[model samples]
Target: MELAKEIAKGAEEEGAEVRIKRVRETLPQELQSRIPLDKVEDIPEVTLEDMKWADGFAIGSPTRYGNIAGALKTFLDTTAVLWKDNLLYGKPVTFFTEASTIHGGHETTILTMSTYAYHFGMVIVPVGYGIPELFQTTTGGGPYGATHLGSKEELDEMERKIARFQGKRIAEVAKKLKS
Candidate 1:
């Protein structure tokens, strides 16, 4: 999604290595194989190995009734091995979500996902109020990380701007923690 890319952009600008992953699609043949999706090599499937290799995380999903998407839930569920190994312990993490409307569970999704981070002993990195966008934004984003509204595949000016703030924040935190 545009918001996801925006967050990555934010981190990349701060010198963080960015990799994008998507949960395995369980959609039907037609829905899953759309033209753009046919290029699967560009966006690799999210794997536990990817989790193991990262210093930090920014997980985003489409809200499903104030909760995370089942696809993402399923992906996370497979990380039992990581949890047991403490593979992600104390790593920084953040989240973002999208919905069709303003109140479409962005906060809840980001907040709820933090429990998973907690389970892994990861540090929760909220976007926080340091960014002016948090105080003045009329669209997505809150104390949680970057957020976006609308069905567009790309972020608008506000969402992109705020996402940059989130990306920089995450990069700073992850950089410090990594050192």
Candidate 2:
């Protein structure tokens, strides 16, 4: 959700109202090293409900073994009920991912996340325009979306810009779709 937070912050700056929330996921012990324990536990039931209510969404997760973390996957798997009702249809959605090592299956993780959006009939928004920082910056983000550089401290100014840009882009798309 870091990317979403960036977007939301940017949207706010642009005089766009934005609401951002996180969905809680259940995870096995093996995955604990990959995600913050507090984040995993503090998730609330309202997150999913909020997802249904939002005009658009930016979903993010850490990559694991060339795919999205099991925790995030588990949370998404629960959305089958939402899918059955076709509630997510027409929503503008985008995804972002982080990984421990460079080349750690970032694309695979994004693809896996994208699959859920596809099933929900949501429009997948790409980061179309290339941000200069993506190729020049030392830390996170690329054409995919805002991403972390595997460590907390690695998230620098460039990452922040990319995150905000991604969020603003999604919000813009959501606004367009809504209109």
Candidate 3:
């Protein structure tokens, strides 16, 4: 959630209105009670209308077996109506992710998520070494998109920088597209 906030911060800095929403949790009540979700409890669950309202998107998720998490995937799978209606076509979109290990599929998660953008005909805006942090960060951030390592609550400086850059870049692109 912190990483999403950083991305939203960058977008807001770039003059884009942002709304942060989380996919609905799919875990059983018993399992959900054990995990800490206080940070996101107040975040509204994302809806099809929100998806239609945004000019662009910065979708974030935690890696699940080197792919997009099931909760996010389930939410995305419900977008066929939008897809059929062509609501997301030509809009810019970016991706971010978190992983438990260095090789825990950060890039793969982003890459897999990009498939959604492709299907929706949204322009994929990747980081592409646009910032020094991408090259320097030992922990997270990459050409695919902003990323973070481990399940820590706080992002490292480099991770935050890269996420901000991605947010700003996407907002700029979306603005240009709008104009």
Candidate 4:
């Protein structure tokens, strides 16, 4: 959630309007009750309409077996109507993710998520070694997208910077496309 906020901050800095929404939980109620969700309870649930409303998007998810979390995948799977209408076509989209370890499929999760963007006809905006932080960080950020090591309580400075850069870059590209 913190990573998403940082990305949103970067977008806002780039003069883009941003909305941060969380995918609805897909876990069974019994299982959901065991995890603490209060920190994100107030964030509005993402909807297909929200996808249409945005000029660009930065999607963040936790990696699950080298894939996007089920909640986010489920949300993306519901976008057939939007896909049919080409509502997201030509828009710029980027991704961010978290994994349990340094080798915990962060890049793969981003790659897997990019398939959705391709099918939606959205342009993928990758980090792509454009920033020095990518070279310096031992923790998260990478060419695929901004990421965080899930073992950390908070993002290290480099991770935060990389995420912010991603947000700013996506917003800049979106603005150019809009104009």
Candidate 5:
């Protein structure tokens, strides 16, 4: 979602600011798809810094075994200090995932990620609209967060609309919460 980040940055031009963070894991194949496998050591420090620096966060991953990827889980595990200090209490957070197939358990991935946010005492924001794409999109975008259904098919216009809306909506809600 590198392209989506630019869109999200633009959505913040009205005064809401957002930043993107990447938490790399140790798996060679997966790390290659995301960051260099050699970069895994940087994940925890970067994650902690980002969590402390931002008022809100949006986490994304490719689901593994119907759950958040191991790398993300490892990063979250390093937040014990934040949890102990209640650093994340009441902050707003959302999650997104990419799945390999159509029924690749994206919703479950969202749920799994939500559990992490809950542990950190962050508020989970669900997609508010009842758009047909929530039920019909072949690619991604849902009330669960922004997602990408990985397959040969490209994202349709409706899915793109929903993703942009999701980013805007989350940023707006985060702004309200901060206020």
Candidate 6:
């Protein structure tokens, strides 16, 4: 959630309209309430209509056993209709992931999620080397996408800058493609 917020903030900072929302959780009812939804303020539940409204997107998730969290994957699975219709084709999209450890499979998570964008025919926007912060970070944020390797409650300065840069880059690409 912190990743998404900062990404959206960065996109808006670059004059792009941004919406921060989450896909419906597929967690079992027994474990659903355990998630502190209020912790990630300002993110609304994402809907298919919302997906259709975006010019670009930054889909993020916490890493789970070297892959995306099940809930997010489940949500992505629900987009088959859009995939079939090619609703997201030509739009720009990027990915981000968070993990508990410094090497906690973040890069793989980003790669796996990129497949979804590929199936949607979306233009991929990588963070690349445009941001000097990427080279200076001891933790998350990479070419695959913006990343986080520590507490979700807070971010290191480097990670924050990378998130901002990734968001800005995504917006810039989306604007170019849109025009």
List the global CA lDDT of all models: 0.83, 0.74, 0.91, 0.91, 0.70, 0.86
Error at 67, model 5, angstroms: 1.0
Best by TM-score: 4
TM-score, every prediction: 0.90, 0.84, 0.96, 0.97, 0.81, 0.93
Count clashing residue pairs in model 4: 0
- Name the better of 1 and 5 by TM-score: 1
Give every collision pair in model 5. Answer: none
Encode model 2's per-residue lDDT on 51-79: one tens digit a residue: 77888888887777878877677778888
TM-score of 4: 0.97
Candidate 1 residue spans exceeding 4 A from truth: 27-42, 151-154
Residues 24-143 of candidate 1: C-alpha lDDT, one tens digit per residue: 866576765542455454787988889999999888887878898777888898999999989999899989988767887888988878889989999988988877867777675887
lDDT of 3 at 28: 82
Poorest lDDT segment (10 consecutive residues) of candidate 4: 30-39
TM-score of 3: 0.96
Q: Give the TM-score of candidate 6.
A: 0.93
Can you write out model 4's per-residue Cα lDDT over 1-179, one digit (the tens) per residue?
A: 88899999999999999999999999898888865578799999998889889999999898888998889889998999999998999999999999889998998999999999999889999989988988898776789889999889888899889999999999999999999
Runs of candidate 5 with Cα error greater than 4 angstroms are 2-14, 28-45, 130-132
Better model by lDDT, 3 or 5?
3
- A best-first ranking of the candidates according to their lDDT comes to 3, 4, 6, 1, 2, 5
Against the true structure, candidate 2 reaches a TM-score of: 0.84
Q: For model 2, how big is the CA root-mean-square deviation?
A: 2.6
Angstrom error at residue 44, model 5: 12
